[model samples]
Target: MAGISKSFFKAEPGQLVESDGELFKITHLMSISSVLAVNIKTNESVRLHVENLVPISPTEVTEKKYEERLHPDLALFSDDEWAEAQRRFQAIKPLLQNPIRTREDAETIATKHKIHPATLYKWLKLYQDAGHVSSLVPTKRGRKTGTKLLASEQEKIIESAIEDIYLSKQRHKPQDVIEEVLRRSRLAKIPPPHPNTVRNRLAVLSPANTLRRRGFKEAARNKYAPILGQFPGADYPFSVVQIDHTEADIILVDEAHRKPIGRPWLTLAIDVYSRMIAGIYITFEKPSATSVGMCLAQAICPKREYLAEVEVGGEWSVWGVMGTVHTDNAKEFRGTVLERACEEYFIDLQWRPVMLPHFGGHVERLMGTMANEIRKLPGTTFSNPTQRKGYDSEGMSALTIKEFERHIVEFIVNVYHQRVHSQIGMSPKQKWELGVLGDANSSGTGVMPIPADPLRIRLDFMPFFERSVQQYGIQIDGISYYDKVLDPYINAADPDNPKAKRSFLIRRDPRDISKVYFLDPVDQRYVPLPYRNIGYPAMSAWELREVQQTLKTQGMRNVDEHMIFEALDRMRVRIEEAKQKTKAARRQQTRIPLPKLPVVVFSKIHSPADKSMNQNERNFGMAEDDPFAQPIKPFDEISIIR
Candidate 1:
């Protein structure tokens, strides 16, 4: 009684209690002022004030029972309690048989159940509303089921804090999130939940989802985004080919002086199905449309003559018209000439999506493999500075450009084509043959044959320029070109725009600037236009620029064609001197084999004077069959006088 309250006594019905050291069992809790009980030893009823009563044993009320007593409005009782309530209803059913219940009947039922008079009517109303005995049971205590702080204003404050402060680029931690949640809750005049509860909620989110919400879209896409697999249609050889460009890791020396030149760029094409190296173009120039064109042309043409030129021991027969060509979003791959060439060959060109490297993985992997092999060579830069820190790549350089090209050709034909690839489980050459032959155990795909006219493909991939035909000839790159076949188109007005000059399509081979191919609109045939200076040496655009630079460095004023050629001859002599003096040049000259001169179709055409000239004099201004030949004098200086 000293510790208990009056309300506590009222809730202790059917509980054992002690009064004046006598144990008693509480029969009923009449009111907060009085409680009725029977003595356990004497079995006599006694009425006592709640202040004089003390509980001997507290009632063992379960969660369900306590909940029922706290909220008696809803149905949330146990099975035994509901059955007892149903029995009480059945007993009162006879009293209200006529369906006309009165106060007397309600009072009688309340007395029979030992409950309050108003509680009986409440039960009857609940029974009528639910039409079931379960409705008579009392509702559970505390907040109702599905009702908590989650639906309260405090939860809204926490969620707003999470969205505004936590899910930001700053990437706040969970403790920071909790602090912000508390601050917002206090600002909104609401109590915040525990920190652990908020942490539990945040734990449900995935790391990717969190990064996507907090970090920028591009970062999230690069780090967490899913990668797409190979294109679905790339199941057969020549079905899909991937093309890409990479700078070789090895530094090369010039053929003439053997001076250390910068690394060369390589444009490579790989067949997706067989994992075969289809085409490759290596040059000291930067990657451009010319490189793409050259690589694709080499891939489409027969490689028998090329193999002989490179002196490869093994057979490299892989060549054909690819069904689809896949490449990156580089400007070189998207050139107008490349698109036109692909269209002419009935090939589909597909550009991979931006920022996705997996689309061109095959070619990229091949480049990596080749770069690894190059690292083993003497003049290799070794990919990065870490691997090349102590090595003197420039000083140890021994291979010239021509020798390196031969080495690459040999590696591709003899080594890479014969080794077993990890993905294909067989050599690239073997897989290619199997795919072409349609072997039952292979991919079972037939290969398309190479085009009938190989020279047409070579002409198609050449870089072109728009020029106007004049009486003198079409001037290109500060050089005048003339041919008798352009007689009809010379001085013609443009049919599309009369005010504008008539433009004709002209294709040039950068490797040889002696002539240009003029596309005749009337007959749709290419005509060769030779340079005005027929005595000029057959040199590349690179060589011409080098010659110009050499003359400028020599303090030559008002440089002309004669001055450029004179400086070029002098530079040739200096290169020969260096070749004999430099250690790199001496080593290269001894170890590397001499390469044959590349043949061009335009070289077949000969002038009248060329036929009369002896073989020694004809070496210059004719095909470069002799590498050590001297430059010929001007055509006017050489007169037969016969």
Candidate 2:
């Protein structure tokens, strides 16, 4: 086994790479997406996709230590040797930024610089392979030529000046460093090194080391640290996805009143391999299982109908249950509800390694990018108080949650997905398509399998309660739901306990209790059960609680379903009346809290083996008693706009 630096994926010519248990020498980098390599033993040439290459770990290599070779001491070269190296660096510098694609291109550059094309290619190979100027220093055959033989005192003086003056918190200028070295040399009664020598030494100091010594350790790590090799397992699209939450840096207005409400939290999922936005969940609600469920559900399902509803003219093709859902160790991600649901769906749920934030680098970086985009909006809070100082974020609030969501989707589909990603050297959508469909150089894994029962998958992630069905239907948190679908289990007794009622599985989307789901015991399929009375206005669990508390304050003791609906109507009227008079009312009424969960009342059933449920035909229709201002759209056209 041999270890390879992750940078080898860039596939510079002259670099050795291993694929499929044989070694190949990269001859040319054709483009970001393609490479040309020749077998070392057989001399047979083959093309490859950059993505098909694996990062070679240094620990596995026994023949050579690549790290030591890549980083050599600049002091080893004499003045003339360093100058020749500098000349070679200057000749190839332009090509580093605008790389030559073929031998003809290299020949053109060689002719312009008056160097033979073969010599230019050799210089390019060494520089690109090591990514340093020192790699260009000509190797000496015998005793090193032009080697600087300085006395111990003079050498110590130069070293001290570089470390203490040039690379200190004060960040002294290069001229200041030269002067310090000269002054020290004068005091010690020693000959001083040339100014060019001092400058060359400064240039050879590792950029990361220089930055760290100058008080920019974090920036150094961000710019220079090895990232791809550190976190593994994201081998292809949908192999590993990172999901996380952050408060959006923009104020939002209420849909109805159009007044400043507050900032909303955004839960985002990004596929690490492609850096594509797998799914997004934005709401006024705090981060909870509800948010995670909605985000994951969106990630695993198609988005054609959703795009139509949002009126965004673009395709968001990334979907399907990911191989693993990676998230931080937050309590919301660790809840039993989420764990159980992922387990049932065969999705691997992994937590970030304890105390290691870099494990979540993908999602965190995506959040930063989204934040940067959001800060440009009119009502942006701008990330911090200093950035927001003198700015009127609340007063400038214009977009409602729905409007903001539309903007985010448009940005993701049109702008972000189309831009070239620095690390992958291609757009996210391009990477995603390549991973799915493949190309001439490699084979794709194919698109992931779409979940057959979207609604059941959603329900599994939502909060659940085990309650025994009764004649009046199911009651949850004092709200009752009824339908003929639950008749089999009505007053059903537990087989294990003859004296006690059998508890059945019931789940609800807290945002809307107008309907709840019943996991029928006999058939193992979920049944949608609307409210027992059916006339209640669709309201969130928060609003329901507010109504319940208001009734209690007004001296009403036993609240019924009818009383709740009647109170809701009055509350809406009061909200409308007060909205114009006070900002608090407008804020309270900011969001209607439309069901964030999918409209899957008519969706198909879960068919995992041994999953028992009653054999009754699933009644896939809005309850006859339920009232609606408009007809509920057929399930096929249903879309979760958020």
Clashing pairs in 2: 3-57, 4-56, 522-613, 522-614, 523-612, 523-613, 523-614, 524-612, 524-613
Which residue pairs come into collision in candidate 1? none
Candidate 2 structure quality by residue, lDDT tens digits, 1-642: 111111112345665666787677778766444568988679999996553444343443455443322332233245567667767877876676574367777778899999998888789898765544667888857645444456668778878999889889999999998999999999988899889878867876768889999999989977865343244478788888889999999998877777887889999999999999988888787798889988998787656556665667777877666768888878888876786556434467877766888888989999999999999898999988998999999889899888999899999999999999988999999998888767899876654544333454466567888888889998987778888877877888876455679888777777767877776655455667877876666787778888899999999988877787789889878988988776667766743444323323343444443134233223123333111112334343221212
State the lDDT of candidate 1 residue by residue for 469-560, as single tens digits: 89888877556788787788888886644666887877777776777777766544556777767776555666677777766677877665
Models, CA RMSD each: 38.7, 23.0
- Top candidate on TM-score is 2
lDDT winner: 2
Model 1 TM-score, 2 decimals = 0.52
